[model samples]
Target: MPETPSALPPPSPSSSLPGLRFAFGTLTVLPVRVTRWDRPAARAGMLCAPLVGVVAGGAAGLLGAVLLLLGAGPLLAAVGAAAVPALLTRGLHLDGLADTADGLGSGKPADDALRIMKQSDIGPFGVLTLVLVLLAQVAALAEAYDGSWAQGVLAAVVSGASARLAMTLAARRGTPAARPEGLGAAVAQTVPVAGALALAALLTALAALAGGALLGTYGAVRAAAAVVVAVATAQSLLRRCVRRFGGVTGDVFGALAETAATAALVVLALG
Candidate 1:
Protein backbone atom coordinates (compact mmCIF):
# COMPACT_ATOMS: atom_id res chain seq x y z
CA MET A 1 0.00 0.00 0.00
CA PRO A 2 1.24 3.53 -0.87
CA GLU A 3 1.88 5.83 2.06
CA THR A 4 -0.45 8.79 2.21
CA PRO A 5 0.95 12.35 2.11
CA SER A 6 0.34 12.80 5.83
CA ALA A 7 2.36 9.69 6.54
CA LEU A 8 5.54 11.42 5.35
CA PRO A 9 8.03 12.60 7.95
CA PRO A 10 7.85 16.11 9.28
CA PRO A 11 9.99 18.67 7.54
CA SER A 12 13.30 19.61 9.10
CA PRO A 13 13.35 22.46 11.64
CA SER A 14 14.83 24.70 8.96
CA SER A 15 13.94 23.37 5.53
CA SER A 16 16.84 25.21 3.86
CA LEU A 17 19.51 24.09 6.32
CA PRO A 18 20.15 20.73 4.72
CA GLY A 19 20.76 22.22 1.32
CA LEU A 20 22.99 24.96 2.68
CA ARG A 21 24.98 22.47 4.66
CA PHE A 22 25.38 20.17 1.71
CA ALA A 23 26.51 22.93 -0.62
CA PHE A 24 29.14 24.34 1.71
CA GLY A 25 30.25 20.96 2.93
CA THR A 26 30.88 19.53 -0.53
CA LEU A 27 31.86 22.58 -2.53
CA THR A 28 34.15 24.21 0.01
CA VAL A 29 36.15 23.30 3.09
CA LEU A 30 33.52 25.14 5.13
CA PRO A 31 32.54 24.04 8.62
CA VAL A 32 28.88 23.40 7.85
CA ARG A 33 27.71 19.97 8.95
CA VAL A 34 25.67 18.20 6.32
CA THR A 35 22.57 16.73 7.90
CA ARG A 36 21.41 14.87 4.82
CA TRP A 37 22.98 13.13 1.83
CA ASP A 38 19.84 12.07 0.00
CA ARG A 39 18.49 13.37 -3.32
CA PRO A 40 16.43 16.15 -1.78
CA ALA A 41 19.48 17.65 -0.14
CA ALA A 42 21.53 17.17 -3.27
CA ARG A 43 18.83 18.83 -5.38
CA ALA A 44 18.72 21.84 -3.14
CA GLY A 45 22.51 21.96 -2.94
CA MET A 46 22.95 21.96 -6.71
CA LEU A 47 20.33 24.66 -7.03
CA CYS A 48 22.17 26.73 -4.46
CA ALA A 49 25.56 26.18 -6.07
CA PRO A 50 25.74 29.62 -7.69
CA LEU A 51 25.42 31.29 -4.30
CA VAL A 52 28.26 29.18 -2.96
CA GLY A 53 30.36 30.31 -5.91
CA VAL A 54 29.46 33.90 -5.20
CA VAL A 55 30.66 33.66 -1.61
CA ALA A 56 33.88 31.85 -2.50
CA GLY A 57 34.53 34.24 -5.36
CA GLY A 58 33.67 37.17 -3.14
CA ALA A 59 36.41 36.12 -0.75
CA ALA A 60 38.81 35.76 -3.65
CA GLY A 61 37.91 39.16 -5.06
CA LEU A 62 38.24 40.79 -1.65
CA LEU A 63 41.70 39.34 -1.28
CA GLY A 64 42.66 40.79 -4.64
CA ALA A 65 41.33 44.20 -3.66
CA VAL A 66 43.24 43.99 -0.38
CA LEU A 67 46.47 43.20 -2.20
CA LEU A 68 45.86 46.14 -4.48
CA LEU A 69 45.39 48.41 -1.48
CA LEU A 70 48.69 47.12 -0.17
CA GLY A 71 50.35 48.40 -3.39
CA ALA A 72 50.68 45.03 -5.12
CA GLY A 73 50.59 45.03 -8.92
CA PRO A 74 47.62 43.73 -10.89
CA LEU A 75 49.36 40.45 -11.72
CA LEU A 76 49.95 39.71 -8.04
CA ALA A 77 46.39 40.68 -7.16
CA ALA A 78 45.09 38.47 -9.94
CA VAL A 79 47.17 35.56 -8.66
CA GLY A 80 45.65 36.05 -5.21
CA ALA A 81 42.17 36.05 -6.70
CA ALA A 82 42.87 32.82 -8.57
CA ALA A 83 44.37 31.09 -5.54
CA VAL A 84 41.61 31.68 -2.99
CA PRO A 85 39.01 29.44 -4.67
CA ALA A 86 41.57 26.65 -4.84
CA LEU A 87 42.31 27.03 -1.14
CA LEU A 88 38.62 27.15 -0.21
CA THR A 89 37.86 23.94 -2.10
CA ARG A 90 41.11 22.27 -0.95
CA GLY A 91 42.20 22.28 -4.60
CA LEU A 92 39.71 19.52 -5.27
CA HIS A 93 38.41 21.11 -8.44
CA LEU A 94 41.89 21.59 -9.86
CA ASP A 95 42.78 18.02 -9.15
CA GLY A 96 39.60 16.93 -10.86
CA LEU A 97 40.41 19.12 -13.83
CA ALA A 98 43.85 17.56 -14.10
CA ASP A 99 42.50 14.05 -13.80
CA THR A 100 39.80 14.70 -16.35
CA ALA A 101 42.35 16.05 -18.78
CA ASP A 102 44.46 12.96 -18.42
CA GLY A 103 41.46 10.73 -18.91
CA LEU A 104 40.16 12.48 -22.00
CA GLY A 105 43.57 12.99 -23.57
CA SER A 106 44.57 9.35 -23.34
CA GLY A 107 42.31 8.37 -26.27
CA LYS A 108 41.92 4.99 -24.59
CA PRO A 109 38.74 2.96 -24.29
CA ALA A 110 36.08 4.31 -21.93
CA ASP A 111 36.90 1.87 -19.15
CA ASP A 112 40.61 2.57 -19.38
CA ALA A 113 39.97 6.33 -19.44
CA LEU A 114 37.85 6.09 -16.35
CA ARG A 115 40.59 4.12 -14.62
CA ILE A 116 43.14 6.78 -15.55
CA MET A 117 40.97 9.45 -13.99
CA LYS A 118 40.59 7.37 -10.85
CA GLN A 119 44.35 7.21 -10.29
CA SER A 120 46.04 9.67 -7.94
CA ASP A 121 48.79 10.77 -10.30
CA ILE A 122 48.64 13.47 -12.95
CA GLY A 123 49.78 12.79 -16.52
CA PRO A 124 51.57 15.05 -19.00
CA PHE A 125 48.28 16.11 -20.56
CA GLY A 126 46.98 17.09 -17.15
CA VAL A 127 50.10 19.13 -16.45
CA LEU A 128 49.93 20.95 -19.79
CA THR A 129 46.20 21.67 -19.50
CA LEU A 130 46.58 22.96 -15.96
CA VAL A 131 49.42 25.27 -16.95
CA LEU A 132 47.51 26.75 -19.88
CA VAL A 133 44.26 27.13 -17.95
CA LEU A 134 45.96 28.76 -14.97
CA LEU A 135 47.96 31.07 -17.20
CA ALA A 136 44.82 32.13 -19.05
CA GLN A 137 42.99 32.84 -15.80
CA VAL A 138 45.83 34.86 -14.28
CA ALA A 139 46.49 36.87 -17.42
CA ALA A 140 42.82 37.70 -17.88
CA LEU A 141 42.43 38.71 -14.25
CA ALA A 142 45.54 40.87 -14.43
CA GLU A 143 44.12 42.72 -17.40
CA ALA A 144 40.82 43.27 -15.63
CA TYR A 145 42.49 44.55 -12.44
CA ASP A 146 44.65 46.88 -14.48
CA GLY A 147 41.46 48.30 -15.93
CA SER A 148 40.04 48.98 -12.41
CA TRP A 149 39.87 47.30 -9.04
CA ALA A 150 36.09 47.17 -9.28
CA GLN A 151 36.30 45.44 -12.63
CA GLY A 152 38.70 42.92 -11.18
CA VAL A 153 36.34 42.18 -8.31
CA LEU A 154 33.37 41.93 -10.62
CA ALA A 155 35.27 39.58 -12.86
CA ALA A 156 36.05 37.29 -9.97
CA VAL A 157 32.47 37.18 -8.64
CA VAL A 158 30.86 36.75 -12.06
CA SER A 159 33.24 34.02 -13.10
CA GLY A 160 32.85 32.19 -9.82
CA ALA A 161 29.05 32.21 -9.94
CA SER A 162 29.00 31.33 -13.60
CA ALA A 163 31.38 28.44 -13.03
CA ARG A 164 29.07 26.83 -10.52
CA LEU A 165 26.08 27.63 -12.69
CA ALA A 166 27.66 25.34 -15.25
CA MET A 167 27.87 22.61 -12.65
CA THR A 168 24.26 23.08 -11.67
CA LEU A 169 23.10 22.73 -15.24
CA ALA A 170 25.33 19.70 -15.67
CA ALA A 171 23.28 18.03 -12.93
CA ARG A 172 19.98 18.61 -14.68
CA ARG A 173 17.68 15.66 -15.21
CA GLY A 174 18.46 13.33 -18.14
CA THR A 175 22.19 13.71 -17.67
CA PRO A 176 23.75 10.31 -17.08
CA ALA A 177 26.48 9.25 -14.70
CA ALA A 178 29.67 7.64 -15.99
CA ARG A 179 30.09 5.67 -12.79
CA PRO A 180 27.62 3.99 -10.49
CA GLU A 181 29.28 5.43 -7.40
CA GLY A 182 31.03 8.54 -6.09
CA LEU A 183 30.15 12.25 -6.11
CA GLY A 184 28.92 12.28 -9.68
CA ALA A 185 26.52 9.43 -9.06
CA ALA A 186 25.33 10.99 -5.84
CA VAL A 187 24.38 14.33 -7.43
CA ALA A 188 23.93 13.61 -11.10
CA GLN A 189 20.54 14.31 -12.64
CA THR A 190 19.24 15.87 -9.46
CA VAL A 191 18.27 19.25 -10.94
CA PRO A 192 15.20 19.88 -13.01
CA VAL A 193 15.98 21.37 -16.38
CA ALA A 194 13.45 24.13 -15.88
CA GLY A 195 14.83 24.91 -12.45
CA ALA A 196 18.34 25.14 -13.83
CA LEU A 197 17.16 27.44 -16.62
CA ALA A 198 15.35 29.70 -14.19
CA LEU A 199 18.44 29.94 -11.99
CA ALA A 200 20.57 30.82 -14.98
CA ALA A 201 18.16 33.57 -16.02
CA LEU A 202 18.11 35.01 -12.52
CA LEU A 203 21.91 35.05 -12.23
CA THR A 204 22.31 36.60 -15.66
CA ALA A 205 19.94 39.38 -14.70
CA LEU A 206 21.78 40.02 -11.44
CA ALA A 207 25.08 40.16 -13.28
CA ALA A 208 23.68 42.76 -15.65
CA LEU A 209 22.34 44.88 -12.81
CA ALA A 210 25.55 44.69 -10.83
CA GLY A 211 27.69 45.36 -13.86
CA GLY A 212 25.68 48.42 -14.80
CA ALA A 213 25.91 49.78 -11.28
CA LEU A 214 29.68 49.27 -11.19
CA LEU A 215 30.96 49.84 -14.75
CA GLY A 216 28.14 51.44 -16.72
CA THR A 217 26.36 50.36 -19.95
CA TYR A 218 29.28 48.62 -21.59
CA GLY A 219 29.97 46.70 -18.43
CA ALA A 220 26.43 45.39 -18.37
CA VAL A 221 26.74 44.02 -21.88
CA ARG A 222 30.08 42.40 -21.19
CA ALA A 223 28.89 40.83 -17.97
CA ALA A 224 25.83 39.27 -19.57
CA ALA A 225 27.89 38.04 -22.52
CA ALA A 226 30.42 36.51 -20.21
CA VAL A 227 27.79 34.37 -18.55
CA VAL A 228 26.25 33.32 -21.84
CA VAL A 229 29.56 32.43 -23.42
CA ALA A 230 30.75 30.65 -20.33
CA VAL A 231 27.65 28.49 -20.24
CA ALA A 232 28.00 27.69 -23.90
CA THR A 233 31.62 26.67 -23.45
CA ALA A 234 30.80 24.42 -20.51
CA GLN A 235 27.95 22.74 -22.38
CA SER A 236 30.27 22.10 -25.28
CA LEU A 237 32.62 20.28 -22.96
CA LEU A 238 29.68 18.45 -21.40
CA ARG A 239 28.59 17.07 -24.77
CA ARG A 240 32.11 15.96 -25.59
CA CYS A 241 32.62 14.31 -22.24
CA VAL A 242 29.34 12.46 -22.51
CA ARG A 243 30.45 11.09 -25.84
CA ARG A 244 33.90 10.14 -24.60
CA PHE A 245 33.15 8.89 -21.10
CA GLY A 246 29.55 7.73 -21.73
CA GLY A 247 28.24 10.06 -18.99
CA VAL A 248 29.07 12.65 -16.37
CA THR A 249 31.61 12.23 -13.57
CA GLY A 250 32.85 14.39 -10.73
CA ASP A 251 35.94 15.18 -12.76
CA VAL A 252 33.84 16.36 -15.69
CA PHE A 253 32.00 18.74 -13.42
CA GLY A 254 35.30 20.22 -12.28
CA ALA A 255 36.46 20.62 -15.85
CA LEU A 256 33.22 22.41 -16.69
CA ALA A 257 33.59 24.79 -13.74
CA GLU A 258 37.19 25.63 -14.58
CA THR A 259 36.39 26.07 -18.23
CA ALA A 260 33.45 28.32 -17.40
CA ALA A 261 35.54 30.44 -15.02
CA THR A 262 38.33 30.84 -17.53
CA ALA A 263 35.88 31.72 -20.30
CA ALA A 264 34.13 34.33 -18.15
CA LEU A 265 37.41 35.99 -17.21
CA VAL A 266 38.56 36.01 -20.80
CA VAL A 267 35.32 37.68 -21.88
CA LEU A 268 35.66 40.30 -19.15
CA ALA A 269 39.23 40.93 -20.29
CA LEU A 270 38.08 41.94 -23.76
CA GLY A 271 38.55 45.64 -24.59
Candidate 2:
Protein backbone atom coordinates (compact mmCIF):
# COMPACT_ATOMS: atom_id res chain seq x y z
CA MET A 1 0.00 0.00 0.00
CA PRO A 2 2.98 2.27 -0.30
CA GLU A 3 2.83 5.17 -2.72
CA THR A 4 3.68 3.85 -6.18
CA PRO A 5 6.45 6.05 -7.44
CA SER A 6 6.02 7.21 -11.00
CA ALA A 7 8.70 6.08 -13.38
CA LEU A 8 11.33 8.71 -14.00
CA PRO A 9 11.04 10.71 -17.15
CA PRO A 10 13.62 13.42 -17.70
CA PRO A 11 14.01 15.56 -14.57
CA SER A 12 12.42 18.97 -14.59
CA PRO A 13 14.72 21.86 -15.31
CA SER A 14 12.76 24.45 -13.32
CA SER A 15 13.63 25.15 -9.70
CA SER A 16 10.28 24.19 -8.09
CA LEU A 17 8.34 22.28 -10.71
CA PRO A 18 9.67 18.83 -9.90
CA GLY A 19 8.65 18.95 -6.24
CA LEU A 20 5.15 20.16 -7.07
CA ARG A 21 4.87 17.34 -9.57
CA PHE A 22 6.15 14.82 -7.03
CA ALA A 23 3.71 15.97 -4.33
CA PHE A 24 0.59 15.92 -6.44
CA GLY A 25 1.76 13.06 -8.62
CA THR A 26 2.29 10.62 -5.75
CA LEU A 27 0.09 12.09 -3.02
CA THR A 28 -3.08 12.41 -5.05
CA VAL A 29 -4.79 11.04 -8.12
CA LEU A 30 -4.22 14.44 -9.69
CA PRO A 31 -3.22 14.51 -13.35
CA VAL A 32 0.18 16.07 -12.80
CA ARG A 33 3.16 14.24 -14.26
CA VAL A 34 6.10 13.54 -11.95
CA THR A 35 9.37 13.93 -13.86
CA ARG A 36 11.82 13.50 -11.03
CA TRP A 37 12.64 10.84 -8.43
CA ASP A 38 15.82 12.28 -7.05
CA ARG A 39 16.30 13.11 -3.34
CA PRO A 40 16.01 16.84 -3.95
CA ALA A 41 12.64 16.38 -5.53
CA ALA A 42 11.58 14.01 -2.79
CA ARG A 43 12.60 16.64 -0.25
CA ALA A 44 10.62 19.27 -2.08
CA GLY A 45 7.65 16.93 -2.34
CA MET A 46 7.72 16.08 1.35
CA LEU A 47 7.72 19.78 2.15
CA CYS A 48 4.87 20.34 -0.28
CA ALA A 49 2.75 17.47 1.05
CA PRO A 50 0.70 19.73 3.33
CA LEU A 51 -0.17 21.93 0.35
CA VAL A 52 -1.48 18.90 -1.48
CA GLY A 53 -3.49 18.02 1.60
CA VAL A 54 -4.99 21.52 1.68
CA VAL A 55 -6.21 21.18 -1.88
CA ALA A 56 -7.52 17.67 -1.36
CA GLY A 57 -9.13 18.44 1.98
CA GLY A 58 -10.56 21.72 0.78
CA ALA A 59 -12.14 19.90 -2.11
CA ALA A 60 -13.61 17.37 0.29
CA GLY A 61 -14.95 20.12 2.54
CA LEU A 62 -16.44 22.02 -0.37
CA LEU A 63 -18.21 18.88 -1.48
CA GLY A 64 -19.70 18.45 1.96
CA ALA A 65 -20.72 22.08 2.09
CA VAL A 66 -22.36 21.76 -1.31
CA LEU A 67 -24.25 18.71 -0.10
CA LEU A 68 -25.51 20.61 2.92
CA LEU A 69 -26.48 23.57 0.76
CA LEU A 70 -28.48 21.17 -1.39
CA GLY A 71 -30.54 20.20 1.67
CA ALA A 72 -28.69 17.05 2.51
CA GLY A 73 -28.74 15.93 6.11
CA PRO A 74 -25.71 16.31 8.33
CA LEU A 75 -25.08 12.59 8.20
CA LEU A 76 -25.13 12.60 4.42
CA ALA A 77 -22.83 15.60 4.27
CA ALA A 78 -20.51 13.87 6.70
CA VAL A 79 -20.46 10.77 4.57
CA GLY A 80 -19.68 12.79 1.46
CA ALA A 81 -16.86 14.57 3.22
CA ALA A 82 -15.51 11.28 4.53
CA ALA A 83 -15.67 9.66 1.09
CA VAL A 84 -13.95 12.40 -0.88
CA PRO A 85 -10.44 12.11 0.54
CA ALA A 86 -10.48 8.33 0.03
CA LEU A 87 -11.77 8.71 -3.49
CA LEU A 88 -9.28 11.46 -4.23
CA THR A 89 -6.36 9.37 -3.06
CA ARG A 90 -7.79 6.22 -4.67
CA GLY A 91 -7.97 4.89 -1.11
CA LEU A 92 -4.20 4.59 -1.10
CA HIS A 93 -3.92 5.85 2.48
CA LEU A 94 -6.67 3.53 3.68
CA ASP A 95 -4.94 0.52 2.14
CA GLY A 96 -1.72 1.56 3.85
CA LEU A 97 -3.56 1.92 7.15
CA ALA A 98 -4.96 -1.57 6.77
CA ASP A 99 -1.58 -3.06 6.01
CA THR A 100 0.08 -1.23 8.87
CA ALA A 101 -2.61 -2.39 11.26
CA ASP A 102 -2.10 -5.97 10.17
CA GLY A 103 1.63 -5.71 10.64
CA LEU A 104 1.46 -4.08 14.06
CA GLY A 105 -1.17 -6.47 15.35
CA SER A 106 0.66 -9.63 14.27
CA GLY A 107 2.69 -9.93 17.48
CA LYS A 108 5.45 -11.41 15.38
CA PRO A 109 9.08 -10.48 14.96
CA ALA A 110 9.83 -7.40 12.88
CA ASP A 111 10.63 -9.46 9.77
CA ASP A 112 7.54 -11.55 10.24
CA ALA A 113 5.43 -8.47 10.80
CA LEU A 114 6.77 -6.81 7.67
CA ARG A 115 5.96 -10.00 5.76
CA ILE A 116 2.42 -9.92 7.08
CA MET A 117 2.12 -6.32 5.95
CA LYS A 118 3.27 -7.27 2.48
CA GLN A 119 0.47 -9.82 2.10
CA SER A 120 -2.42 -8.71 -0.05
CA ASP A 121 -5.24 -10.06 2.07
CA ILE A 122 -6.73 -7.95 4.82
CA GLY A 123 -6.29 -9.54 8.22
CA PRO A 124 -8.86 -9.36 11.02
CA PHE A 125 -6.97 -6.64 12.78
CA GLY A 126 -6.73 -4.59 9.62
CA VAL A 127 -10.42 -4.95 8.87
CA LEU A 128 -11.44 -4.07 12.41
CA THR A 129 -9.11 -1.12 12.50
CA LEU A 130 -10.39 0.21 9.20
CA VAL A 131 -13.98 -0.12 10.28
CA LEU A 132 -13.41 1.62 13.59
CA VAL A 133 -11.30 4.38 12.09
CA LEU A 134 -13.84 5.11 9.40
CA LEU A 135 -16.62 5.08 11.94
CA ALA A 136 -14.79 7.59 14.09
CA GLN A 137 -14.15 9.84 11.11
CA VAL A 138 -17.75 9.76 9.93
CA ALA A 139 -19.16 10.21 13.39
CA ALA A 140 -16.96 13.19 14.08
CA LEU A 141 -17.87 14.84 10.84
CA ALA A 142 -21.54 14.30 11.50
CA GLU A 143 -21.21 15.90 14.88
CA ALA A 144 -19.50 18.95 13.41
CA TYR A 145 -22.15 19.28 10.72
CA ASP A 146 -24.91 18.99 13.28
CA GLY A 147 -23.43 21.95 15.08
CA SER A 148 -23.20 23.95 11.84
CA TRP A 149 -22.12 23.55 8.22
CA ALA A 150 -19.19 25.88 8.79
CA GLN A 151 -17.94 23.64 11.59
CA GLY A 152 -18.15 20.62 9.35
CA VAL A 153 -16.15 22.31 6.60
CA LEU A 154 -13.60 23.53 9.11
CA ALA A 155 -13.17 20.07 10.57
CA ALA A 156 -12.72 18.50 7.15
CA VAL A 157 -10.11 20.98 5.97
CA VAL A 158 -8.20 21.02 9.24
CA SER A 159 -8.18 17.25 9.57
CA GLY A 160 -7.11 16.75 5.98
CA ALA A 161 -4.29 19.30 6.08
CA SER A 162 -3.12 18.23 9.51
CA ALA A 163 -2.95 14.64 8.33
CA ARG A 164 -0.34 15.48 5.69
CA LEU A 165 1.49 17.84 7.99
CA ALA A 166 2.17 14.76 10.07
CA MET A 167 4.22 13.36 7.22
CA THR A 168 6.35 16.50 7.01
CA LEU A 169 7.31 15.87 10.59
CA ALA A 170 7.93 12.21 9.88
CA ALA A 171 10.21 13.12 7.01
CA ARG A 172 12.32 15.44 9.12
CA ARG A 173 16.03 14.71 8.82
CA GLY A 174 17.25 11.72 10.86
CA THR A 175 14.06 9.68 10.60
CA PRO A 176 15.00 6.39 8.95
CA ALA A 177 13.11 4.28 6.46
CA ALA A 178 12.16 0.75 7.32
CA ARG A 179 13.38 -0.74 4.09
CA PRO A 180 15.65 0.00 1.16
CA GLU A 181 12.84 0.31 -1.38
CA GLY A 182 9.40 1.85 -1.65
CA LEU A 183 7.90 5.30 -0.94
CA GLY A 184 9.25 5.47 2.59
CA ALA A 185 12.78 4.85 1.39
CA ALA A 186 12.41 7.51 -1.25
CA VAL A 187 11.22 10.29 1.05
CA ALA A 188 12.44 9.38 4.48
CA GLN A 189 14.34 12.02 6.42
CA THR A 190 14.07 14.35 3.48
CA VAL A 191 12.94 17.56 5.27
CA PRO A 192 15.10 19.81 7.35
CA VAL A 193 14.06 20.33 10.99
CA ALA A 194 13.86 24.10 10.56
CA GLY A 195 11.82 23.81 7.41
CA ALA A 196 9.38 21.39 9.01
CA LEU A 197 8.99 23.53 12.10
CA ALA A 198 8.45 26.68 10.07
CA LEU A 199 5.79 25.08 7.88
CA ALA A 200 4.10 23.60 10.93
CA ALA A 201 3.93 27.04 12.52
CA LEU A 202 2.50 28.50 9.36
CA LEU A 203 -0.05 25.72 9.09
CA THR A 204 -1.12 26.15 12.70
CA ALA A 205 -1.57 29.87 12.13
CA LEU A 206 -3.58 29.29 8.99
CA ALA A 207 -5.74 26.82 10.87
CA ALA A 208 -6.46 29.48 13.46
CA LEU A 209 -7.35 31.96 10.76
CA ALA A 210 -9.60 29.44 9.03
CA GLY A 211 -11.31 28.68 12.30
CA GLY A 212 -11.64 32.33 13.21
CA ALA A 213 -13.14 33.12 9.85
CA LEU A 214 -15.58 30.26 10.10
CA LEU A 215 -16.51 30.20 13.76
CA GLY A 216 -14.86 32.70 16.16
CA THR A 217 -11.91 33.17 18.50
CA TYR A 218 -12.82 29.96 20.27
CA GLY A 219 -13.00 28.20 16.95
CA ALA A 220 -9.57 29.53 16.10
CA VAL A 221 -8.15 28.13 19.33
CA ARG A 222 -9.80 24.78 18.80
CA ALA A 223 -8.68 24.60 15.19
CA ALA A 224 -5.11 25.26 16.22
CA ALA A 225 -5.49 22.66 18.95
CA ALA A 226 -6.81 20.18 16.41
CA VAL A 227 -3.65 20.54 14.35
CA VAL A 228 -1.49 20.18 17.41
CA VAL A 229 -3.44 17.16 18.56
CA ALA A 230 -3.39 15.60 15.13
CA VAL A 231 0.35 16.03 14.78
CA ALA A 232 0.95 14.71 18.28
CA THR A 233 -1.23 11.68 17.66
CA ALA A 234 0.50 10.95 14.38
CA GLN A 235 3.90 11.38 15.95
CA SER A 236 3.01 8.83 18.60
CA LEU A 237 1.94 6.34 15.97
CA LEU A 238 5.02 7.04 13.84
CA ARG A 239 7.30 6.37 16.77
CA ARG A 240 5.49 3.15 17.59
CA CYS A 241 5.55 1.97 13.99
CA VAL A 242 9.24 2.77 13.75
CA ARG A 243 9.97 0.81 16.93
CA ARG A 244 7.76 -2.13 16.02
CA PHE A 245 8.63 -2.38 12.37
CA GLY A 246 12.31 -1.39 12.68
CA GLY A 247 11.63 1.95 10.98
CA VAL A 248 9.03 3.82 8.96
CA THR A 249 7.42 2.21 5.91
CA GLY A 250 4.84 3.19 3.34
CA ASP A 251 2.22 1.50 5.50
CA VAL A 252 3.47 3.44 8.51
CA PHE A 253 3.02 6.67 6.62
CA GLY A 254 -0.55 5.69 5.82
CA ALA A 255 -1.22 4.83 9.41
CA LEU A 256 0.09 8.19 10.55
CA ALA A 257 -2.09 10.12 8.09
CA GLU A 258 -5.24 8.29 9.09
CA THR A 259 -4.38 8.60 12.74
CA ALA A 260 -3.76 12.34 12.45
CA ALA A 261 -6.92 12.94 10.48
CA THR A 262 -9.02 10.97 12.92
CA ALA A 263 -7.43 12.69 15.89
CA ALA A 264 -8.17 16.11 14.42
CA LEU A 265 -11.77 15.19 13.82
CA VAL A 266 -12.14 13.90 17.34
CA VAL A 267 -10.76 17.09 18.83
CA LEU A 268 -12.94 19.22 16.62
CA ALA A 269 -15.99 17.25 17.66
CA LEU A 270 -15.42 18.10 21.27
CA GLY A 271 -17.76 20.81 22.51
- The TM-score leader among the candidates is 1
Give the clash count for each candidate. Answer: 0, 0
lDDT of 1: 0.90
Runs in model 1 deviating more than 4 A are 1-15
- Structure candidate 2, residue pairs in collision: none
RMSD score of candidate 2 (Å): 4.2
Q: Write the per-residue lDDT of candidate 2 for residues 1-271, one digit (tens) a residue.
A: 3333333232345636889899899889989999988777887888889998888888888888899999999999999999999998898899999999999899999999999998989999999999999999999999998898889989999999998999888987778888889999999877778889999999999999999998999999999999999999999998888889888888888788899999999999997
Assess each prediction's global lDDT (C-alpha) against the native: 0.90, 0.88
Per-model TM-score, in order, reads 0.95, 0.94
Point to the candidate with the largest lDDT.
1
lDDT of 1 by residue, 1-271 (tens): 3222233233345546788888889989989888988776777888889999999889998999999999999999999999999999888888888998999999999999999999999999999999999999999999989988899999999999999999999998778889988888878887778889999999999999989999999999999999999999999999989999999999998899999999999999998
